[model samples]
Target: MLVQGETTFEDCLVSLNVLCDVLLTVAKLMYPLPEFVLIHKDESVLKDIESLENFRLNVYKVTLSQDCELYDVELHTEPNYPTLGKKFGVKSIAEKIRQMTDTDIEKLLSKGESESPLIIIDDVPIESEGVHFFFRVVKQTQFEAIAKQGCVVLLDYTADAALKDEGRIQEITSRIQKLRKEAFFYVNY
Candidate 1:
């Protein structure tokens, strides 16, 4: 997002707003929608996914790989926690996490969780292989009617560029599928 090295916070805010608008535009083009809202610093959206109306379509929660950076670990101690609650922010840090390279993360997965002991409570050490920001999905169980209508709900936390790139990929995939069906391919085998 800071590609051009903007010199002011105002520039950053404006950039973020522009990014959100672009993302919404891309999402709308790719997905069917009755409504879409761009929320800034809003947590109310996470309360209940089932209550959300999904344009008479099935909603699915898609989870991708964990993305973490050096600043990502700083949420453990900050103004963010005192106001937003501990659970609202990333709460733990592993040794070398701030300095760990992508190669390090990949090597960690290959080895095991035994290396990084994250926390200790009541004198017992709690081990963590790695830290990740988890995005959990709340299903719409109460609305049987909406479920039958095919409402797919998705929440993504990727960068704006990544989102746009993925949307384009989805568009290509959809076109390929459409062409495949149009060619009269048999389902057998």
Candidate 2:
């Protein structure tokens, strides 16, 4: 099959920003909660509140559904706007991506890299040359579920040392849970 229009390194960055925002939003839901803003009522009028607005996250995936022939492939990034807007006092994923220089993207996309944020273009597996361009979601990004009007969590094993060995952690947790069950402590998943 013939491939058309080059997929630049910058395109990868845009995609990553979208993905990271989704992941972080999931993190907020499952693990740590976002800061609770206690709106003061004495001066003017306000109530204590955390964000109650619904957030939308859209991920564009490469597909071969319509046509067989290769066509002009442009990176479409309109969906990531809202997530970028909810910045945590730090640069939003989108803005951080915007701030990156071309050289920075080049380096980030280069081969022989020992780092997090593994970049994969299309559904292809890791190659020796590293982050080359193609288009499609990787296996890792495959969505098993989408929670509407509710919270969801995505676990990150690498973030903590204890979490690195997930099987061991799960086993230990299971054992503790069994002991709890024997002790009349019943918690549900």
- The lDDT leader among the candidates is 1
Candidate 1's TM-score reads 0.22
lDDT tens readout by residue for model 1, 35-69: 32222122344334335544343223422121223
**What lDDT, from 0 to 1, does candidate 1 have?**
0.39
TM-score of 2: 0.16
**C-alpha lDDT score of every prediction, in listed order:** 0.39, 0.35
Across residues 35-54, which tens digit of lDDT does each residue of candidate 2 receive? 11121213222211122223
Show the lowest summed lDDT stretch of 10 residues, model 2: 59-68
**C-alpha lDDT (0 to 100) for residue 42 of candidate 2:** 32
Once fitted onto the true fold, the runs of candidate 2 whose alpha carbons sit more than 4 angstroms away are 1-93, 111-114, 117-189
Per-model TM-score, in order, reads 0.22, 0.16
